[model samples]
Target: MLNQFLDNISLPAATVTSATAEVQYWKEDLGGIGTVRAVNGVEVTTEAQGVISAIHFKSGQYVQKGDLLAEIFAEPEKAQLQVLDAELRLARRNYVRIKALLDRGVTTESDLDTARSTLDQVVANIEVQRARVDQRVIVAPFSGVLGIRQIDLGQNVSPGEAVVSLQQLDPIFVDFSLPEKNYATVKSGLPVILITDAFPGNSYRGKITAVDPQVDSASRNFLIQATLKNPKQHLRPGMFAQVSVQIDAQRKVLVIPRTALIFAPYGVAVFVLEPDENGDQMIAAKRFVKTGEERGDLVEITQGLLEGDIVASSGLLKLRNGESAIINNQNQPPENANPKPGNS
Candidate 1:
């Protein structure tokens, strides 16, 4: 009766695809939130307290270094400059006349010295007047884009009062912070990838330019700066950014397709191929695996999976433990694990 019952029971094979868990290159990325800033930025301010005389640059204008932006009340200083120039010329003429007379034994040495002293005093006065006149003019310290105009014509601006904001947007800086544990891993020149809400679905590439020497005691994180090229000026200062730093070079690791994973209430598992009792046919053996970072279609298997071990890539819903499997590699999915959508 037992032999007759066993003869009536038939075993069926399940068709599935299998992939070898081989060593593939993997990179460890450290992620952090950052803010965009200009490499050189400043609030243009007045050094001299005077009424504005003329405005040269418009709001949101691109200016070159040393370009005049505005001018204060300089009429008084300019008039003093003219008086100093006349006095210097008159003193110089008197000095030359006195020196000629002394050479002819007609004028004393004291007279020549007095004329030379007068000429020197006038030259010094001219230099002081020139400096006073320059103080009224506001010039851009560096080449950059200007912000909104803060002062109007005939407005009295005091010293240290903000006039405008100047920022060099090209080759901008991104400042981010990393944990203290990753201190040794991060350094200058590491490649960085940035994304901001201002420009969605786009990535900006840059490299680490500076790393803070000390870590913050409160947060135990250190600051790092990366330089990104902004030729189009799409990235503005003070914008929020998400940053990823590739800490190390790509190294080989055991990897498998993500479709192979079976989600269970207990843990994640996968079906691996094993030999049957006769050693001729392959059977599915459920394996609980520890997973690491995931890159698109591929996942890093940290435990319970070895290199060269074949695992099921698809058709996992119907598979059972110790069940017969038929691997078909011809109809496998594309192996491109990580596909960049909007990155250049």
Candidate 2:
């Protein structure tokens, strides 16, 4: 009965059509979720140790560079400055008097020189004291939003102590990693599409700004940073994100429905259909092909096939090379006939 069925069965002929060739660049996605962080974040601190005499700005306030955020107790330094001013005035008076006396030959040039030196030393001391007093106050280093205040008014803070944190939020960074195998494909300035669970239906576009030169030994992945412009400050730091880097678009390539290729022990092969003499259609030949990569329902044919070759999309297993076939071009299969698991 099986032999009779095989004898009655006839192979179907596929119409020959020219296909445009494309060169597709494919990449494997290594899953890693990262947050949107500022490219520059720093804590502003006082340069000199002093008690916070006054806090000028509240927590979470936006501040500009050189804006006064806090002021330390500078009363002692003010008092010292006043004393130095008095000393400088007295030294200048003595120097003037000595210069006049020396010019009139009433005193030695040595006395005039000593008085000038005294005035210079007192002026230098005043400048030194002024610098020391200026160090008591803390100011914002850049224009950014200030974090929560770490010290309260009247609280003593040591040098290098954190007064508040500042972060530039206008432009943020989406940092992620890709496997070492994909390192060659990722380059600076490539466009990246960013998606986050925090904000659904909204996608932020960015470009690759940096790529780590060395691969991580432990994870065997290379680090990449993409800069995303956040004008509205909607995206915050530590927000989980999904990033897609577009390497390049595939131009033109000879592709077939992925289901058309039959995998066998010998090699991957596809049945091509052609018309024989006397207007009879048949599976003209079985050609072994080398497939490069697959995308969606299409597979690229790198070799063993021409542009106009037609291949069987269904019922390929029962057909053999040179078997007689009937031409059935109608009832075409769907565009994406070969559906894989988990692929929509």
Per-candidate total of colliding backbone pairs: 0, 5
Prediction 1 TM-score vs. true: 0.72
What TM-score do all the candidates reach, one by one? 0.72, 0.63
- Candidate 2 differs from the real structure by a C-alpha RMSD in angstroms, to one decimal, of 6.8
Candidate 1 local lDDT, residue 299: 86
lDDT of 2 at 190: 89
User: What digit string (tens of lDDT, one per residue) describes model 1 on residues 152-257?
Assistant: 9999999999999999999999999999999999989999999998888889999999999999999999999999999999889999999999876776778898
Residues 1-344 of candidate 2 have per-residue lDDT tens digits of 99999988855543432122334444543344566888678988888888899989988888888899999999999999999999999999999999998889999988988999999999999999999998987888788888898999889889999999898897899899888988888889988888887777788888989999999999998899999999988777778898888766544566777777889898998877765776645545788999975767788889988877767776665666888655454654443423545532
Quote the positional error of residue 326 for candidate 1 in Å: 15
Candidate 2 accuracy as TM-score:
0.63
For all candidates in order, the CA lDDT equals 0.92, 0.79
Model 1 CA deviation exceeding 4 Å by range: 1-24, 181-185, 255-291, 294-301, 304-344
